[model samples]
Target chain A: MSDNSNNNAYWAANMRIIKIFLVIWFICSFGFGILLRPLLSGIAVGGTDLGFWFAQQGSILVFLVLIFAYASRMNKLDREHGVDE
Target chain B: MDQFTLNLLIVGATFALYIGIAIWARAGTTSEFYAAGRGVNPVMNGMATGADWMSAASFISMAGIIAFGGYDTSAYLMGWTGGYVLLAMLLAPYLRKFGKYTVPEFIGDRFYSGSARMVAVICLIVASVTYVIGQMTGVGVAFSRFLEVSNATGLYIGAGIVFLYAVLGGMKGITYTQVAQYVVLIIAYTIPAVFISLQLTGNPIPALGLFSEHTASGQPLLTTLEGLLSDLGFATYTEQHDTTLNMFLFTVSLMIGTAGLPHVIVRFFTVPTVKDARSSAGWALVFIALLYLTAPAVGAMARLNLITTFYPNGTTEAPLSLEEIQNNEALDWVRNWEKTGLLKFDDKNGDGNIAYVANGEANELTVNRDIIVLANPEIAQLPGWVIALVAAGGLAAALSTAAGLLMAIASAVSHDLIKGQLNPNISEKGELLAARIAMGVAIAVATYLGLNPPGFAAQTVALAFGLAAASIFPALMMGIFSKRINNKGAVAGMVAGLIVTIVYIFLHKGWFFIPGTNSFTDADPLLLSIKSTSFGAVGALVNFIVAYLVSNATDDVPADVQELVESIRIPRGAGSAVDH
Candidate 1:
């Protein structure tokens, strides 16, 4: 029963990390890229506003980082939880 | 070799490679057929998924869409890629842990009802079939242009090739072929962009070049593009022209729709473990970003190139004369595409010069922007082999996606419908045979539709995404997240979503999209301030609310079923939990 409890705790921690990273991911793309475009109108990147950059290029770059971060962290989590393949 | 022969040879060789791989990887068992025995590596699966997800619209038409619509169309870029984040966070890992062969399988098991499964199956079919028709039409367009064949003939040829591989190899075959396709497509796409980038901005990287200074105008690339386009009465390339509310809803809808697509979700099932599935989605996005990052650049640069081609002295000067356009070999692509009836230009008002203006009312020249990507190499005076390679690449994009969609359809028929619900006792061998037969029939139907597309390629794809968003997305999400969603509730939600979305689309587009029956468009949608394109997200929301309300009114879910939901929630021990 203790082992099962520990496993559940481990899974919960992993989900917590995913949720946090996903929030960042969501903000970068949907927030900065779309909804917050007007707010980001003052900050310019190249010829366009920061929000435009976020929509076309910046959000995609951040997505790459988020994914890799999740992968590396989750792998470590898997090992700690004794669930590593 | 001549351009025609080179195109045939390159396309032929690629088709042969796909066929060879299909035969070698031919699935012998149901497990191999559906999920390739779940042995695919994260990286390989990522590449295959990238190829599967990047349809002809991404490869051939996206840049053109952006080129014309400018910053207003950034929704396409954001909406398409934003969905990957949703998939990674909300869907991928849990679904992978659920360990189902199809999306409907999860719905059925999670809700514990055959009727729910049937509803999910119907949704999947409608979305997949509609999606596959678009892909088939893309294949036809690519083949017809490059091979100088009729669209119908090209579609038949494409159907024959897809039937060869998809029917033979199933998921196992399609996975490996898709990897090859990713390589061909990325190379085909990036090489020309790199060349154009260097030519226009002196930056080797297309993505960077998009922001770099335009060598000709001595201004920031995007700024110059915006100025030139606005001068010609086009929307600014970097300015927001679409209504903010519509853009927000459209992007959200696309993200949800992407997460819910059965074909894409099923790709995750091929990974060996739940954790791998999570990372695989990341890797898939990484591969996809390589092109997504470059597409906007291609769109901006291609538009600039096209403008400069006509207005050599900038938009302030008179446009290129007819003799100049006809005599220039660099502009031969325009003439070539004109022959196929895909590209057209009329010297209206009997002017010797072609006025390339974006004003819908005043512009006499009508150029199908779809030709821009297809004719980019020719427009820029690239080599014959590069042009031929583009042909092969476009075909790869179209064919790979078509094969994936057909496989998804076939599996839904064989696994979810026949074996799981109808037969239950059918042998694995019989099931595999049924899958192949279903695939053959699906291909035949798609080919027939391709021969006579109800609408243009991009328009049909929008409908496909709409259907997926409205029906499948809601049912799948509610099934996993809301345990109280009873079988009846889930079924009711899916049917409601499907009917509403389809009826709305039909009313706006046409009944069965028969072309003459449509009453409205993006300008005058049925609902208050809602376009047909944005209706899918609304439909999905309605599905969720209805499901929740109905489920709340019903008896509580069985305790054991709740435990199953708990099992799916935890990532730990899921790898070992797979039923052997």
Candidate 2:
């Protein structure tokens, strides 16, 4: 990471990963759980629809996975870009 | 072996454990005092963060809210946990690389203005102080209920315990003590959930039991709950009843606020490196999920249990007669809680049986929402020690969060104000003394407020979150992400965000939360379908818009500040957190 371009490239890659994960975050919580809930009412989990499960339980599980996944991806990106400490 | 002594023994044991940890982990330097010397392991830091984040609200009130609010309150479940994702990806690592001891110090340096630092401090104090008052009151409530003391005595004892540890050990003591607190709270929380889950659904794991069969009715647990609630004229347990827009904004506000809260943010500063900071947040969320996952099951189950207690055969069956309730050993909890004035029953229609229904006039039971979690073990007949453990867990949750908030407040006053401005040449030893003194003062103020709380004590959670989301989060994000945002833009954005959020909250919640001064009520807020709690996201948008416009209209950020921003972007050459 000696040059300005290298730093910029590393940052861009990091942002790309963040944007992708954030999309999943949004879809799982706000979309599937709220706005698009009615579309998923046909699918049942336990006693309620999948949308209800997503709202109460599934969204939280997804958030946990998203964070750990981001951390690993960013760590790998750091080494690939020679930005590892 | 009696319930009161058992409660005293367990509560006493936990307090002794905390004090012992404090003495063992006492800080001798400013580094240790403020950031735990930046030597903490990532996993241990994660556990500490869990206890620091899950306050009395989470341990005590969240399940009750979820039990009654049903699908509408999932906003809280997702919002609080989802914010960890934002913190890890957007904020924590870069802030760790910046290597600062406090949030305002990072703001002060990044924006290159004393005024920006001052604004950050003000925002930090207001949000944290509001937050701490709730924790103090929670501590009082837990102590009074479990220890059989007056609320005032409970608060004083709680304050003295905090002063001993926080004043003596600072962040180092708090970090280790919070780890122990996390273990105690998680165990205390999950043990009864497991028993209830098994009893109700034949599953040992409460989270799994939530989606499993209800053994009594041979239906899914949630489905049975939904059926029971609606049969009794209550909203279905698994359906969304609130408006989509309000729920969306409210969840967004809570997420942003969780990411930006100064107390929670400062926990990341305790870890050794930027990578540790990133992964530590992930670990923290994992710890919190242990309780968060079990909470829904507890809520749904407790609600079901309460309803069935009244209508033993079913909701359609005749309700319990007063004679049955008075004689049954299982109904002992009702009698116990009734002594505290938390549970009450009346024969509104002059019938022999108690009526629990949605209609106001004929309904005969009035239970305070706060007692649900405290009274849960007994509700399930889980035995004496389990109930005692809940008392300890509630205190652990309250005290851990109160310590973290006090740490944030103390550091802001001592590190940002006194060392950074008032007495720049103060010795390190002198600064540590000031920090301890600030902790003492903060604890005193928090105790006072807890005793004579403003009418909005319960409402302050929304205010604290709104202020953090509206003001602090956006400024910190822009400071790291954008080089064009100058000092004037940051200050203008923060003030605009703060004022808009506070004014909007006051419009509905009264001026400074005074009861009678409100112009509009939350039932019919000024904005269409947007409660004051949900206005944080909008305030954040206003902040960004004002900041972008203001930055373009003003002079560009200096060259040095641009370099500073670039350096925080990468994790290379990162070091331990710095004070100056």
Candidate topping lDDT: 2
Error of 2 at B451 (Å): 6.1
lDDT, candidate 1, B96-143, per-residue tens: 888767888888889889898888888998888777777787777787
After superposing all C-alphas onto the true structure, candidate 1 shows an RMSD in angstroms of 2.7
Off by over 4 Å in 1: A1-15, A76-85, B23-37, B168-174, B425-433, B444-456, B575-580
lDDT of 2 by residue, B37-128 (tens): 26777778889889999987788777877888888888878888999999999999999898877899999999899999999998888778
Looking at candidate 1, what is the lDDT of residue B201? 93
**Docking quality level of the chain pair in candidate 2:** high
Tell how far residue B194 is off in model 1, in angstroms: 0.4
For TM-score, the strongest prediction is: 2
Q: DockQ numbers for every candidate?
A: 0.55, 0.83
